[model samples]
Target: MVAIELKIGSFKAEYAGKMNLYLSLLDRFERGENENQSIGIILCADKDHLDVEIALQDINKPIGVAEYQLLLSKEELQTLVVNEIKASTKEEG
Candidate 1:
């Protein structure tokens, strides 16, 4: 299982704590006995790499933080998807 949290602004230290809580809950209640541990992904509109690094340094969970863009036009979005598909096909080949 993967838990995702989306934020509109920059990354905050508290976000990591929130995600940790989510992962814990999922592991306790939702995860199956044979399943692997839950993972977490935090997506923010902007983030500082150093801040994210520090925030997750001491944590043992499989969590990751990434930035997202909201300003892409429809054409740009389509192009990106197409390119990603092409890249993935090449890898599979």
Candidate 2:
């Protein structure tokens, strides 16, 4: 299996913990379930690309790193919340 490593950028350690929440994320990027193994590293803030490069000195594996961003508007947030409640109400009905 090709071992894969994931480096995720986060605002804080709390958010970095979400890395575990996506344990299955790399499965799709993989060529096949038996063809690769995945690993992940959560960075609270990576100021430079070089920083991560240095941090992974001895590790030799197929790796990937990405930054996540969120954008929300007041109306969009409210609409989503209302829609969720409506969906639940329908379930109960």
Candidate 3:
């Protein structure tokens, strides 16, 4: 299971706590007996590496923090699509 949380601004320490709660709930109540532990992903518009490190330092569950662009340029989107196609083709080949 994967739980994703999206934020519009910079990452905050509280976000990590919130994700931890979600992960805990999922793991305790929703996860299957044989399923792998749930993973959490927090996506923010901006993040500081140090802040992320500090926030996640003591976390035992699998969680990832990443920055996301609110809007990508047309060219950027096209490039991403092309790259995705190439990746899929390679996988199929």
Candidate 4:
């Protein structure tokens, strides 16, 4: 079984500690003796790549940090990006 954590806030080192605790608990109580090692994923709304790297440096278990996106239509996202670029350009000008 896999353990998944979803967070809408920034990723932090403290989250790794929590993941470790959860994995440990799953292994002890949830996983069967012959089951594959549990997998852990931390899906956050925002994450600093460098911070995530440093946070997972010493972690022995399998853990991954990834970002999630809202299910917006492609055109909507494109429009948002174009508007942002236009705003930025206008401000710069």
Instruction: Give the alpha-carbon lDDT of every model.
Output: 0.94, 0.49, 0.95, 0.91
lDDT of candidate 1 over 1-93, digit per residue (tens): 999998979999999989999999999999999999999999998999999999999888999999998788878988999999999999999
Count of clashes in candidate 3: 0
Across residues 17-74, which tens digit of lDDT does each residue of candidate 3 receive?
9999999999999999999999999999899999999999999999999998847886
RMSD in order of candidates: 7.7, 7.1, 6.9, 12.0
Compose the digit string of candidate 2's lDDT tens values, residues 38-72: 55544332434565455445445433445544356
Residue pairs in steric clash, candidate 2?
none
Question: How do the residues 12-93 of candidate 4 rate in per-residue lDDT, one tens digit apiece?
Answer: 8899889988998999999998998898999997899999999999999999999998688778989999999999999999
Which candidate achieves the best lDDT against the true structure?
Answer: 3
- TM-scores of the candidates are 0.75, 0.35, 0.75, 0.73
Model 4's alpha-carbon lDDT is: 0.91
The better candidate by TM-score, 1 or 2, is: 1
Better of 1 and 4 by TM-score: 1
What's the CA RMSD of model 4 in angstroms? 12.0
Clashes of each: 0, 0, 0, 0
Which residue runs does candidate 4 get wrong by more than 4 Å? Answer: 72-93
